[model samples]
Target: MIYWSANSTNSNQQSLSGSNPKKKVHSGNANNELEWRDLEDYPLNLSQQEVMIEEGKAGSSWGKSEINSGYNSLLSRTLQVKGSKVNCFFDTEAPKILVVDDHAASRMTAAALLAMEGYEVIEADSGAAAVVLVTQKHPDLILLDVMMPGMDGFEVCHLLKQDEHTRLIPVIFITALNDRRSRIRGIEVGADDFLTKPFDRVELAARVKSLVRQKRLNEDLDHAEQVLFSIARAIESRDPNTGDHCERLVTLGQNFGEYLNLSRSQLRDLMWGGYLHDIGKVGIPDAVLLKNEQLTLEDWEMMQQHVLIGEKICQPLRSMRGVIPIIRHHHERWNGSGYPDGLKSNEIPFLAQVFQLIDIYDALTSERPYKRAFSPAEALSVMWEETQAGWRNPELMQRFTDFIHTYNLK
Candidate 1:
């Protein structure tokens, strides 16, 4: 039995559909005309939702292989706000939630509660159906029932968590079983929270709201990283020497970070930092960047300014604050000798240090104007020489080298 007490407080009681519809267009170019989509004015009623579901089901059968990319295009929009980082508006569209349970009553009750608060809700009656819905609907949060006929909640969660695209969507297990073993299993499978069956309405709303807010923050942060990477990649495209160097750094760096059992935050920073470390180069002149011979002192000085330029370029975006150190400090030396700032050794940001190693490895392996590409063995030997001169962290170098060789990172 689930309790469904309505919110009685008179202070600002409005259902999601009844809320203000006139939203500032979160998308479109500022240089042209701004466009606004009033969500409240065009709310989807039950009948409309049924029609969309039926249409989606019919479309699904035609392209079963494309289910991996199935996204509820109806619920999500590409939010592109234009302006200087300062003059822009930041708004998050409402969170899309998927409620998965065998009981129709539970799904209806939960959906009504979530909708009243402001979240858009979708329903899935079985684990298999929920898995399919996840890829297609792309819900921000999932409330899953523990016991079902074939695929249990634990199995469903494991499968979702295994997929990178769906993993970030938080899963809260709803179960009648309150045993220690069941709880342990949920944690093992990466369930974010647990709701013991026979639910409390207030608790449900609170948990859903809290999780959705956190997920939104993470999504925003990820979007920021992607923008930074894309800008850098565009600049890299101008130079023939760099192809997918920035992207490769992210992939290789993430692998090395994981092999070392680095925390999730550290790995995220490594990926973002690897792509962004050279963003300062976007400002460097082509003469200095593309010169075949060694750089003159003047050209070297101008090149060095890239790090500072990158730091200033990213300063306006609050979402990129975590990566600032990485952009600024990656060129710093192990022995207080390298770039923009003279600070060395422990003065280097830890995350920057992690990415610096990845950046160097990628560069060494890549073909450049003045240098031939080095094989993996040759690259390791060169890095060893740097360690001998105290130019790099000996311990981190050793671990990174071992990981690459062990995994055959090519």
Candidate 2:
């Protein structure tokens, strides 16, 4: 017979053995106190026989088949046995499901079903409660019910989707309303899927699994983007004169894209390009990159290779496909006098042209070691001269000029 102890402060330590099995032994902190509970009365049976002992914040699993088979599992996979005052070790891999329904019966039913599948389940009685739980717990998936008393599922989904942090967590509306209008509205509010009342166990499981998988993939992509941005920021840190250049470009490019009524995809590309456009400079030597004077012919050639290198570095990520053109062609001139490809007007990508305008404006306005910062009017005049000299797109230049003046972005 296996015996579990709680709040045992006896300083004696003993190993589990057949001959000298002690009634109680403390392995962790003496101050830790876990509530005494019988494991046999627990609901679910865990497949594994290991008992996890949590000491303070750290935890380790001990006792294989030696643990009593009659002991069932806690909500987590491992049977938690705290020594005086210890918490349980939470299962990080388990997918957390939030079930939102005003009706207690419906919410309990869904929560029970999910718990049976080994998923950690959270319950919310109303739409507002669901939102609060989402922020607090950040569940992997949400099973929502429609026709609630206060904020309905539609409103909840809408609010979640509008926030960038919560938007990606997949929401499945499980309501009695199977009308086409309801489904359309659900889709509009960014519901990943829908299930009519009395959702089939098999179907619900399949949908949840699929959406959760997709969410994981999106998380991986986001992680990759963050790494790339960190590298870009590090590269920028190499230049003392370019303070917050990437951030400035992102803000300006986003504003310009919005002013031009560009598509959302295009705006995203512009934002990414702002950080990644000069990322190729990572390949350039300090002599060329940090030079305060005009570049020598050899230095200029080496500097020009950065764009190509940046494009190559970013090409493997499928999400960067839209920004590749800006990375590669932002340096190209309208009159074909630029470096690398030297494509003339119309040959250059429009996004690249838009970004190039922003880049040039920022460079002119910001002080560099080689040149003093120009006033807004002076910068505009210089850009107009470049446009007149067939080195820039006149129409885009005109619109950008208007955008700057309208926004008073100095």
Best by TM-score: 2
Q: Which stretches of candidate 2 lie over 4 Å from their true place?
A: 1-92
TM-score of 1: 0.67
In order, the Cα lDDT scores of the candidates are 0.70, 0.75
lDDT of 2 by residue, 1-410 (tens): 12233333322232222332442333353322122222222332221122223334212222222221332221112112323111122224667788888765556456544554555667777787788778877988999987788899999999999998999899999766547887888999999999876656567667877787788789888888888899899999999899999999999999999999999999999999999999999999998999887889999889999999999989989999999999999999999999689899999999999999999999999998778999988999999999999999999999999999987955
Cα deviation at 357, candidate 1, in Å, is 4.3
Can you write out model 1's per-residue Cα lDDT over 162-235, one digit (the tens) per residue? 99888889999987755677788999999999987556667887798778778878887778766877888878
- Residue 262 error, candidate 1, Å: 4.5
Global local distance difference test of model 2: 0.75
Least lDDT summed over 10 consecutive residues: which range in candidate 2? Answer: 71-80
Residue 358's lDDT within candidate 2 is: 97
